[model samples]
Target chain A: MTASGTPASTGPASVPHLDVDPFDMAFFADPYPTHQRLREAGPVVYLDRWNVYGVARYAEVHAVLNDPATFCSSRGVGLSDFKKETPWRPPSLILEADPPAHTRTRAVLSKVLSPTVMKQVRDRFAAAAEERVDALLDQRSFDAITDLAEAYPLSIFPDALGLKPEGREHLIPYASVVFNAFGPPNELRQQAIARSSPHQAYVAEQCQRDNLAPGGFGACIHAQADAGAITATEAPLLVRSLLSAGLDTTVNGIGAAVYCLARFPEQWQRLRDDLTLARNAFEEAVRFESPVQTFFRTTTREVELSGATIGEGEKVLMFLAAANRDPRRWDQPDSYDITRRTSGHVGFGSGIHMCVGQLVARLEGEVMLTALARRIARIEITGEPKRRFNNTLRGLDSLPVTITPA
Target chain B: MPAITFIHPDGKSEHVETSGGESVMQAATRHGLDGILAECGGNAMCATCHVYVDESWLARLPAVAGDEDALLDGTAAERLPNSRLSCQINITPELDGLVLKLPERQV
Candidate 1:
């Protein structure tokens, strides 16, 4: 069941077919069942409506992600291929580019976000997280998503990026459109783009060198431009990459962490028993919830995966969230265990183009969860959690939680 | 406890007291060192945790696996003859006092 070049079904037309419109509204609401059906269908499932082939099992999805050259991203990591159709926004300098371009942009970004540079902001982030936790706990009962997850990243991340604080409110709506647009011109995407239209300018404006506060990550990206690492034009786009990527992913991740801890009280008690589990808890929640669910990759050549030989330029939809929970790769795949070694999960993706801001995400998750665990004795979900609908990102819109103070 | 020496990009050496069953990347991060990006959290994905093992100790380590080798080709720094991803290198007592040079950058 590993990522073999052979398909479960022989020949291309005989490819295991599933009529699931992955971008449909209902599928986004609860993807797990569809995920299960897709995985069980075959290693490679053909979606007729979109005319895209999908790999849902861990082995096949992992293979698609790892073999980026064969399953390229340069064409566009979305349903809209860059060559044939216009992208909603400028393609990511990091996420959507390949090889030579990706190599340079990634180098500059990694250098800007290198662990050493990140450590400088740790104390500041930890302090903000601690303050947010204490303030939220005073309320005792609040919507975890809005009051905590959304509130925290918005407050700290923008300031850290050296963005002008006045228009920072736009990050979330803008993020929704950006992530949603990856699926298709679906209702969710079209609606989000219209809703976020006013605020989209704020995102691009925040990346301007003149708009950035001195000596922040944004400024560093500009500095790289000065150093000839990236062009002056690529600088702002790279900055856009950071804000669009770093913000919502962390928020959903934090949301998932809080949601998971509340649902799994024993795991919460484990965190209370040992604060050191904070980082691992966040990672497990990522594996369990998989905030960013799916990304499309294009075939560079006639590639044989599972048992079908997919032709060149064919889009391969990689179900990352499904892969993380694949039964073949993990034991008790659906269970959330803070202590489980979450290595090899495609939650942050794999290969050359893995999440560059993941260190920041982990730091944010660790600080916030640690501060909460140290003060909160128990996390009880006060009401049923409501699902947040997004084309690609999976998260809770509202998680009512009542925390008992330690 | 077996010891591992991590030669940082800035040439500051932090000889960590380590144990078996943890990655060298984990050893560095666990001790709060400046090297090793480990962006995918040691999923053998990002080559940001690239390190160059001293030739003497290179033979003691496990040979690079296919995925790890494929990723090594994309390291920001030139792929040295001794280059390997620290995440792929597990700690073992037999290789106590092992040393790995951190690259200037491992994007």
Candidate 2:
């Protein structure tokens, strides 16, 4: 055993075991059961075939996320250890590094993504959300995911990041692959890799300084590099961070919000009654059905968890969705309640590496939620919602709904 | 009111009255002390509020947690061993004479 009491073996028998396969259909259809099983199994449960330790309990997940020194991010946050294989394109400059290096790069990008600067594009985002929702309202029967959720972000985020219209098509598939790559190289990763090839060049081209719009965040990151705050090479990857995180997460978040509101009509009416509740509704949805399901971190040293020992260099997967539903942290954990205080949940993650683009996400949700509250008197699912398959993110492929006009 | 001194990047010191319950970042921002930006709103998500704790007060302050230390890795300014996010440092009677050196920039 190592100093902290974790077994030093790299073999299958050394790690604590778990029963759930994250990519399985049942877990995908409803992950809470698997979450409960993992949490009940142990604080750090190892999956034999996947060869990773999983942390499903709320407290353990929180601890792992906050203690990056013990559980580092440099080995690539994905399931395939970066040390063993090179990443397909390149690792996200922001998501792939630990501090000192991560700090300098994050600083440059944060300035470009500052709340004041993001405010500049808020109205355009709101208008785009309204236009898309209105187009669906005219039909009165549309897939909430394809028609509204995907349509809205696809319309706004890329343009805001300074990509041209033709390049917009590549946004979703590329981002899906990136997030999927964070998981084991299962059928999901294979499928995403196959579909994502066509858009790689367009995504890479948009990373160039000349290709970005003059005043957008992407160009601004390059400007910071020019000013000696960051290197020119770091600029594109930082822009890629925005592109990679911007689209899929928000789309799933918004989709989750719609699913919750429709599932609980009383909550939708509450939002309609007071527009301020729009923000609360969106945030609560994140707490209710976390979009980015799970992310991994490598233990830098032997660390003691609730009852298990996580060895040095061992991988730990934090189930954000499971943690969000953890009974230890929330009252009636399964119920979707907007009024409940949810700000502390790890939906956007916790600790230093928490989502930098959260404000951008909130702004997007607020705009869409407000527009729907204003235009639609009531909404209910007309058909069973279809789930979009991904190893790490839970999103809708289609949510057919009937919209009653306000 | 306890007076907290913030030594700016330019070597200027600004004193502000801080409430017992508020964090150092909250007090500085509330009093318009320049050079500190708590961008994540004190959630420890962003390292914008980084400051070097004065050596005199280091022994009195609680040790930084593993999570906070990990976050300190990504600050724009070079991190000294005494570095802490001002948001995590709450003011109290024991910390009345606390002093922090503000970094040159907040990303």
Candidate 3:
């Protein structure tokens, strides 16, 4: 579509073009290898097929995330042409916006989801996490991903957001589609779209203020609208942001942390010995294995990064996962070490648009992991783990683990 | 342990003894000082725990980096020149008797 042979627009000569085959199963199974290759090949690789420039290195990725003026989010962060596809529902008022609009929406939601306000739900979330872990540990053997990790967030986040129990079943699959839609339309997107159709109405209904529980975050958002902090029209879209971002991300993060601990029993022992490491352990896990792999930003103008040029309006995929592991930034990047004072990691993203729900996510991980470490003597993998297929979310399908109680 | 005083927006001052290794925000949080809310658990991601250091003791604190500076722009209240995210400031003996003015709101 452009002079650089990428689908979007003409990029400068230094930008290396990479044509990513959306259908590649190996790429799907393990994208890290491809990410590594892209990182090594060049700092800015323009994918001709996907019509996007890929920034795999840490510095460039960080730069793109920080400089929102140069790399805008308004053209739609997802691969879909929002003008054409127009989204089955409205775009996320938070995620899909560029500044000024994003600034206002984020300011409103930030207050609603503030840590002080969130503290009200902290004990409830911790108790729920403890209960879920207790139930799973009682079974002795369970799929860590589905039973503990996924179950905990699904049980806690939705109820906290005030979605009805029956209608709430659609949250995960719907969220999976929303994340997958960030990438190119492939079999994965097709599959998710096919699966999500049945629950579309249920999902839409939950976004309405009337459907939200009184005093929950969703209701608070509508209240903010009523108070003129945000427009009434933006209320459901904000609720959609919470629903879309809240659960699956935390599920993957918690699962990844547990998987890392199980793989490294020494780390598990350390956590068991001192439960305070539970918080840092999650941060370390995110640093080691980032759950949200990549998010694309459309370059607003020609920007120079890592001795290369990224053209205007070109989709730049910031490989946060690869960046977290880049040897340029980290020492012993691959090891799962909880004590490794891991701050500044891009797992929750970077710059102004980082994950707003990260506090809640950290609380969930800390509570459950602390509970597990306190009660369980050891965690061992009883069977091979299964990986969930999503273009964006790097998560587990099943992680069979045996918990030996202390 | 290091001693630190937090000056609330209401001009109320509270002093608390904090462990050397704990972040100022954490010490305030552990003491249940109504002000500092370290939302991201001291990852320096969120700017909830905003405070203005007493100008005389400002030079004693570490220089604010670009990241912290950018986050300060998002603070809930009007940010003073010495505005710092309390999470980024760890408790040290050098910071003993350090006075910080808490903002009216974290969000």
Candidate 4:
């Protein structure tokens, strides 16, 4: 029974309806107010226009992400339900799948991304990070988004994937389009589609074994196919999965940290005192300003959370950014304190389908932030940071920053 | 500080000082004892921190509850009788010399 004593299985007519357009520019730029409204509206609020259910509270969003069997991600974790509409492209081998298929694919990807493998790649990442930091520090004034956040990942991740440097510019827009397409086909989605075709072709061509370097993540995934862990055709799609989900999140995450540090310079000072705090600082920033903010999960069966009941196959939106700052789950939620034990914040998500490349993302963050802390004594925002909106991802369009060398 | 030993998939082991309140996964990550991803950063959500508790230390730790039990099913390595998510096991005085054998990989 709900706190309000509403029957758990009440139909759409009796449900509390919210008419907010979460995809609009206003909501995308500043969503906390709407998120608060959604959370206060009820545990389960019906979005009348979208014909979907929305949950912004931490407990509800975390619970839904964990109980994948009840709230399925296989049907597409986007506004459009995969069951009702045909997929725009072949679904991600890992992201858009469920067990036992998910089980097999996840096992393969996880092992490939496990710490054992990730360790060998770190020193290389750190060295590149230090080099990038030195360059940025020398310049002192640069757009953190394009100069570092975008440039760093674009250079390193593709090299790690054994992607040829030629046509590498496609990674950012390719990922942007992929993430943007997750929402309704609004102007943003339409624009992304128009800009994405060439980049998508480059990514597709790069996924082939001969096109990839022999020892990269792409080739490692193909080796699994040779071992009969997955099919030959499935190999390229898995590489495509890494390209789609990995790079953009890391770019935005680093961007978020730069933005956070610029806003909260004291946190940056704490990092200067102790460089070990890089990963912790990054984790806290993710908690404070989540990059991949929201995802949709389709209900597999009738379910009641808090008070609202959602029927099977209906889209349920989980506001991850909202969950990260839910006052019920956090103390002084808006403040970004590096000391906060920010793990389990749903920033990298939770449960079976968590971000497969989170470790890599954290590694990138640690490298960049730690490198900066070692050299830069202070940070100043030379101009206002601009917001880049997508249906699911939160990132900066550009952040102009000037650093003072230690 | 009480120290813990982490054994990687290749059977390599390293001992690192473990803080009283931190989880075993934190000790490993802090000291750069690779193989423990702790991807969710010690959150019970990701089973990447899965390890086989030393038979001697198994019963001394708290019984697995919550999401740890379910997440075990997602590990890339085979789940054994002494299997546990290290993140669920907080370091303490009684468990000073905790030994955890990380799986071949965490799914």
Chain B alone, TM-score, model 1: 0.94
lDDT of 4: 0.84
Q: How are the candidates ranked when ordered by lDDT, highest leading?
A: 1, 4, 2, 3
Better of 1 and 3 by lDDT: 1
How far out, in Å, is residue A14 in model 4? 4.1
Alpha-carbon runs more than 4 Å astray in model 4: A1-9, B1-55, B59-84, B88-107
Candidate 2 clashing pairs, residues 3+ apart or interchain: A16-A46, A66-B67, A99-B73, A100-B73, A103-B74
Best by lDDT: 1
Q: What is the interface RMSD of candidate 4, in Å?
A: 5.8
**Per-model TM against the reference:** 0.83, 0.81, 0.81, 0.83
Tens digits of per-residue lDDT for model 3, A1-406: 5665664433545566666753356776777677778888887887777776788788888888888898877777777656446775577788888888898898777777665665578789888877986797679998998888888898888878887777677888878988887878788877777777765667778989989999888999999988998988889889888888898899999999999999999999899888867987988887787889888877777767776766666777788998988888777887999887465578888777888888788878888888888888988899988888887888889999888888
Highest DockQ: give the candidate number.
4
lDDT of 1 at A347: 89
lDDT measured at residue A75 in model 4 versus the true structure, 0 to 100 = 94
TM-score between predicted and true chain B, model 4: 0.92
lDDT of 2 at A240: 84
Specify the poorest-scoring 10-residue window by lDDT in model 3 chain A.
Answer: A4-13
